[model samples]
Target: MQKSLKDLKVYSSSDFPSYLPKLNALYDDLFSGGKGFRSKLIQMVSRHLSLKNEAVYLLAQTIEFIHNASLLHDDLVDRSSLRRNKTTAWLKYTPEYAVLAGDYLLARVMVNLSEFGNIRLIQYTAEMISDLLEGEWIQDSLVGEWNVTLEQLNQVHNLKTASLFKWCLRAPFVAQETYDEDIHQLLDEMGGLLGLLFQRSDDLLDFNVRNYEGKAILGDLKSGYMNSFAAFLLQDCEEALRLKFKKAQSLDEVKLLVTPDLFERRLQEFDQVNQESIDLYLHLMEQLAQALPEKEQGLRDDLIKLPHPLYWRKR
Candidate 1:
């Protein structure tokens, strides 16, 4: 059965161990703060198959575990003070606690996956963990560098951000006893493309936009990091413009270069790259649609809901 936001919200309302207040708090931090985008993915896919009742809880929990684990480490690495509008784990609690909490969540994933008793599910979850960590490492290596190529950045994001998403689309099929090679590969490709689109669209938010940038704008540039979309945009900037962007040392310099005027100019060049990325993401989702011969009604609504949010994101 497909779970609703109301459903998952109610299901997850109870607190964890009272003795482990910090751990419980960590869980709450990630759980309540985020919109459960990935959980939505799993829910959508589940609609198309005869997914077990247990699959909903296990799969939802697994996605949260993977996401929260990454967030704990992400905050420490980014030294970010705010996440979803509050102090981060490493800030409110000690980094040691954060690390342990993150580790515990990952361990919990194994226990959660075991409930499904599917080796493939567990194995895919394991591979996602590896991919997520590797993606983080690659991005970390690029920190403080002002010029990362679009292809390299996208490759890293695909591995890190999309790998888990791929799992979201495919796991339900695997769990439904409806596993197929083509569907699995197609879902992975779809997840990667969606990940690319989501991340790149998010990158545009860093430039300039009205109302729905969602997060802080131009935060990436001020921080001296380049995203996949920005990399494409930067690739075409004049030598002098490139030097200005590369030489940026503070938020002021970033504002001067990454203004509305400059961004609009760059959008022209970003058109081809943007189209390519859109095609990539759409193609993946298309494959998923094709792979499932008879999707359930709830699955259909969920699948329809998938693109709506992604489409409205600032670009």
Candidate 2:
């Protein structure tokens, strides 16, 4: 049986040099609390392709490093104080250490990929990292632009969150030297939809819709970043409510208008508008499950389970 994500060993002292004590410890602390969603996604896709466990584990580690590295940098950029319900690396450790630690992880990813001796994997991962950073920059530019449209928000999420998902689904095939263009394209679409769903679900948590792991609520609004849920809700609302939300300066001010009654109504409206996205996510997964040559129904079963609760649930 494949090891569970919790049991996957991502860090070893041998991977790091003895000189960098802060970076080493920072990685240990950051990796400990994550549920390893990215890696789990990779494992699901790999099983469908019948890839070897050794290669899957390496790809898992590589993607996890990329994901966590982004979190480290994201914490610094967002000035987030807490992550996974603990002090963020940038705050818990020095900001310099946090930045360097992110760099170290990216560097390690390259080294491992190079040792794996796959040119395509290296190229694809490099592009994914670039896409993630571009998304970060675009999101930073849009801060305080409360009138941001759903299309713009989709672009940001596609790059920032979905790029990694795209890579996770496609990388196993790349590692195995499979060049099926149609399968790769399908996986890309599936990953993109999954990323959008995951990000939007996460944004809803800011409204206290659900606390998957006790994440901070209203942090996006507090930081002047309008979340996807708020952006979608603002689109169809009355002008008075729109103006009220636009003029408010803090989370509390927004809260006054987004009362329980108003929130409930808007939540339903938000779901109504985005129902197509939810439908597409399931559709793509079903398509992939049937399209794969190997019959790994379990992979599709696990993937389906991930977003089941995110569609319409309040908690």
Candidate 3:
């Protein structure tokens, strides 16, 4: 039976031990006001299979725990002040508390998975976590590297962002003991494209393009990080312009350096390139439909609606 969204709670107060001081309060803040999109994705995929309700919830909670744990470490590493429009966990609680909380979540994931008795799921998740750490290390190295290319950023995105998406698509099937290599490979490719599109669209937000969310503009540039769109925009610029681009403190300063017309043009080009990716993802969906069992064909419909809204930011 397909479960309703309301029936699925990825985080519950009872899930963690109450004896740890401030841990519950910290988690209450951590899990609140966030999108929880990854957990929802897990539920969406699991519903199409013969997964029991308990198994579906476990998968959803596992992904959320892993993702939020990364965010806790990331905010501290980047010295970020805010997440989800609130003070970051590292600052709100002591940095030590934040680190411990994040580690606890990961530990709990292993405990829960072990109780569930799925060795493959536990191994796959551990590998994904390692990929995330590797990606973060590479991304930190790219800071202040003005000449970084989109290809390089994509490599980081694949490991850091796409790994989660791949798990979301593949893990539910893995839980059901479906070890079909071709299906998993196709899902992996689709997840990579989705991660690329989502990250690039988020990069566009830094430039205020379709930035309905009103994210602080030029945060990446000011932080000495050249996001995907920025790399594409400055790909062909001269050394002098690149130097000026790095010093930009505001969006207007960015526009002044690149010129308003060229900025718009580069944005259009960036969107066009990503549109091609969206098309490729849709094509893969067709192949995925053919590979899935007839009863599971409806899963494609739920997934097909993801790319356009994810990239275009127009749900």
Q: What local distance difference test score does each model get?
A: 0.72, 0.82, 0.91
Q: Report RMSD (Å) for each prediction in the order shown.
A: 3.2, 2.9, 1.7
lDDT per residue (tens digit) for residues 81-175 in model 1: 88889888888888998898888878878976786688988887898899899999999888766567888998888888878877888778777
Against the true structure, whose TM-score is highest? Answer: 3
Per-residue lDDT of 70-187 in model 2, one digit per residue for the tens?
Answer: 9999999989888887899999898998999999899989999999899999999999999999999999998888788888999999999999989988998899888778778878
| lDDT comparison, 1 vs 2, better candidate | 2
- Tens digits of per-residue lDDT for model 3, 1-101: 65455757788888888786599999999999878899899988988998988888899999999999999999998899999999999999989999999
The deviation in Å at residue 233 for candidate 1 is 2.0
lDDT for 120 in candidate 2 is 94
- The regions of model 3 sitting more than 4 angstroms off are 1-7
Whole-model lDDT, model 3: 0.91
Give residue 246's lDDT in candidate 1 (0 to 100): 61
Cα RMSD for candidate 2? Answer: 2.9
The regions of model 1 sitting more than 4 angstroms off are 1-6, 10-15, 210-214, 236-240, 246-262, 280-288, 295-305
lDDT, residue 17, candidate 1: 56
